[model samples]
Target: MTNLKIALIGNPNVGKTSLFNALTGMNQRVGNYPGITVERKVGNFSLNNQTQATIIDLPGVYSINPTSTDEEVALQVFFDQTNKDYPDVVVVVAEAENLKRNLLLFLQIRDLGFPTLLCINMADQMQKKGISIDIPALEKKLNTKIVLTSTRQQEGIDQLKSEILALVNAPTTSPFDIKTINPEYFSAIEKNFPTIPPFKVWMALTQNFFSTEIPLDKIEHFRQNHSIDVKKIQHKEVVKRYQFINEVLKKTYTLDTTKETDVRMKLDRIFTHKIFGYVQFIIILGVIFGAVFELAKFPMDFIEGSFEDLSNWVLDTFPKGKLTDLIANGVLMGLSGVLMFVPQISILFLLIAILEDSGYMSRMVFLMDKIMRPFGLNGKSVIPLVSGTACAIPAIMAARNIENPKERFITMLITPFTTCSARIPIYIIIISVIIPQTYIAGFIPLQALVMVGMYAVGFVVAMLAGKLLSKLLKYKQESYFIIEMPTYKVPIFKNVLLTVYEKVLSYITNAGKIILALSIILWFLGSHGGENYNNAEEIVTQSEAAQTMDKEELEFAIAKYESENSYIGKIGQAIQPIFAPLGYDWKTSIGILTSFAARETFVGTLSTLYNLGDDFEEQETQIIERMKNEKRPDGTPVFGLATGLSLLMFYAFAMQCTSTIAITKKELNSWKWTAYQMFGMTIFAYIMALLVYQLVK
Candidate 1:
């Protein structure tokens, strides 16, 4: 009859979030808390006509006492009773294949005294592999209800929902009936702090009493009454808990080793070989990047044209004024912001999801460990590099698995150099305008070939940077890459669709909001300025009297003045001398600055600049021609080979995504590192651009 909060909690790679997505559908919102890196995902679904339930998908963690930042966020929800609303029922999702390993967290949740249900996921995989679970027997043993689910097949979903609904009425159960820890120590803790839950006290002890300050009176009582050393006692209790899990699994599960070796081992030998493994890994990654770039072009062109037509139509229907300018320049630009990257981002996520689902990503990590070691990184940092191609933010967060501090810090520092999809829009716009479209080898467009070359440059440079950093930073920690290569299975269509949906929607929700706000603010600045800037028409008329200039010349001069005097223009001018050696004018300088917000803003900024006096479609030819024929103070073309090459270098290496900065801050555990990344990348990009510009010029 009312709403309830249900949480899906589990260790990483157990498909907890997948189950949550299957249940919640499109009713979801993603954002962060005011002061945390943890992504809070809450979605609502109705269990019946009379009752609604909200599901919270917390980040995956091994245990409540966390060593990693993400794990700490998960632990906060579990440990902080002061949280406004704790889950009404905890669904402990565990993989049926790795039941024992997964149950470690499940048992811990049960000890928290929540009304709990054990969800044994991946049931289909178990059946296919000739593994089976006696669900009722296991449920009775743990004293908890069980739901066998295969989220990929949509199996047991209805039954799971019904069980969760029933949990609202079922009494809470202590499934992790602790029998291993010394009873005297547990008794002493409970007796010392009368109000503190016995389980919380035990968790606090296991975590070495981290942040758990008992009242002064309770602390005095405990110290006076007992002679236990807290650290030594806590260490002994943790060992005992794992010892208990090992014993429980011994009786309950059986594995067929001979059958396991049939395919999984045979595959692993080739996939993780000392020499061939790294080679195979590189080939796989190259193919993924190569395929997405080629296959996504047709759809990208279609979307580009569709947005152009849409903007033109809007400009035609609306009368010219401040409002129409805002619609054509601001809103259309914002929608284009959302549309332009759909093809590349969609294909990227599709490929990544398939690899991740098949568990090939893990194998790739293990293989790359040898190479990554010399670069101050281990196998786990490979995900961040791969993900950085789509966006560095998620890639940076994925570095959570890298336990080594020095390696992780370097991984975060260098990930921005791995060309991301945000850079795609910048590459497309510039390559089309500058790189000639004549056939290379009388076949492929030279422009497209150049774009591909630029991407390769970014990848090569990123690896080289990583290797150099590894040598410079003297780390002697013994680090190795251990990975699990799961059995191959057909990628579930629903899971693929859900993953793409979530990633794409996130791009739109987060990046779109930033672009929309910036575009409006930019429009206001370009439209209304003080003194000679206020009236463009009058200023152009006054300038035309001296030379009897043509309409195009008069308009160009007026546009230059308006851009120079606008608020953003002042910023561009202030920074222009820094870029002037690279053959960039104030306008190009502004594009570079705005691009850090997002690389897609390159076209949007350029469009806004020229479209101040006319519609975007109408000015497309003029804008291209202006860039082509326009000259510098030294009378050289503004966009010759020199400036074009320079611009490409800048976009290729720059730290150009705001979302990435936010994520880096979260992952590195400080704004200090985020600042270092931004400043370091900017200076690096500037130097590379300068050298390229001078050589070409």
Candidate 2:
């Protein structure tokens, strides 16, 4: 089979991603370009039986002229000057209605020396918008194969594949004559190094590519030794390129000036209206949170029940010992806790995908940008801040697009303050335990209100932090914010499902690994103790109170005594006093400590701790039930409203995820900030938790 790499590159919102999705389907993987935070998407497809190729969806940019790190990566890879991720054939997707504007980028890639295909995407909408393109004239003028494709219409893909497969190395026509534009500039490059590709030399001189394919020191030297005014040369080049592009597009494209704006604009007016926008956004968010619980109820129940049954079966099937306990209360319990959240998470991912693919997400950025400006962040920070709701690690990574270092720093610092999905498991379980299930208007769930409140708590905290940080942290750099609102279209089902599948699977798999290992270790710690645990059976049976108890009652009492004396109990007792002010006993304290590995592990820890050795039966138990039944030494219910509310507040504000902290350290490249975030957030969490508990108690 022939192996090749095809890069899908174009301006943002040009349907490049849609085309890539059309070709690659579910065969794509998203990672990062080496040593950069920019997302990299690569996938596999076969043009023919023997013509298998990998397609990379490079970050979309307006031009090869680099400003942001994202654009730099695109240019570096296009010049075949990257360590890896160089494309064999560059497929530049352009909107048929806006070819003139899109051609600027296509022309840059064409000159940088690569076999290229120009795809006029959204062709189906062209005629309706009174747009027309002379395809043959364009192909001839640009000296490339131009394929008309409507990824939405599923048109022209097969022809595109045939063209790609039949292509051979071809020289670029009208490749910019650098000498004509600036003889001194060309002469300086040739004089220093004649062997290098002219464009590479031209690009290297104009701006630092900072690519791994070339030595960094050599680029720096070329930069330092040269007497080039970079901005001046870049300006001259842009003028010269546009001079050529204007001549080409004059005859090849036409648009009707009287074209009517589509329904998208009509909808955008109301949705993006100043007065209605925020109100509508909030209403949608309310529906989403409420629907998450409502839609996930059946699936969550099924998953919960299945795992519970499995745990019970494992206990009965295996020989009763530590191994059996480990598999039942540890592994099975942990896996169940992680997987149970899949239903809610899947809903969240699916809904988010719909909103993003439908192009409404950009409007959200537009709306929030106004609100974020006062908080020291620009509109661009909105993406990362919004993404924080999914998971903080990726959200922090998303902040790389914020061009201003100060703004990016502020974004990264406050992003974790947003409530993430990991907190949902924590929130929902607690809400179930403390909040009544009564409805307000016969349909709205009271528990769902608590869920929304939890999210609101995070958002408000993040906004306040942003406002404060904007005042405290000082850095000087011009921040840039520009976003394209793509023409709205029906979201592709396969793509939406693919996104949800990848995100949900990633969440469950990562959380499961940590929880499973912790559960086993915790079970071991909870099962064994010093002399107190060993003598529990004899001591409890010999007690004068046990003489009046029936056999079953006596057995349960002995089991309770053994559990309390276990090593895990001793550890919890050691830390119990510290959390006593927050209404947390030692057992709850242990749950908090275990959750440092991950917030979702809190529920799993409680499950493992409360799992029955004596009450092993076919019937299953819920975490809420076990927690509800828990008691203090004074025989008061352990998880009352005061304790549940305090715990909720703590998790809401605390930086509990070690994974998030480690990622923050790696992304920010500083352990000091990570340390500050961890300790600062935790201290705040403890104080608030204490306050809530004290007032409520």
Q: For candidate 1, what is the lDDT?
A: 0.72
lDDT of each: 0.72, 0.76
Q: Give candidate 2's TM-score.
A: 0.82
lDDT, candidate 2, 188-253, per-residue tens: 766766655556666755655543444566667766776777677777877887787788888888
Q: List the residue pairs that clash in candidate 2.
A: none
- Residue lDDT tens for model 1, 621-697: 66666667778788878888889889999888888766566556655557786787788878898899999999988
How much is the lDDT of residue 229 in candidate 2? 71
- Model 2 superposed RMSD (Cα): 5.2
Which one is best on lDDT? 2
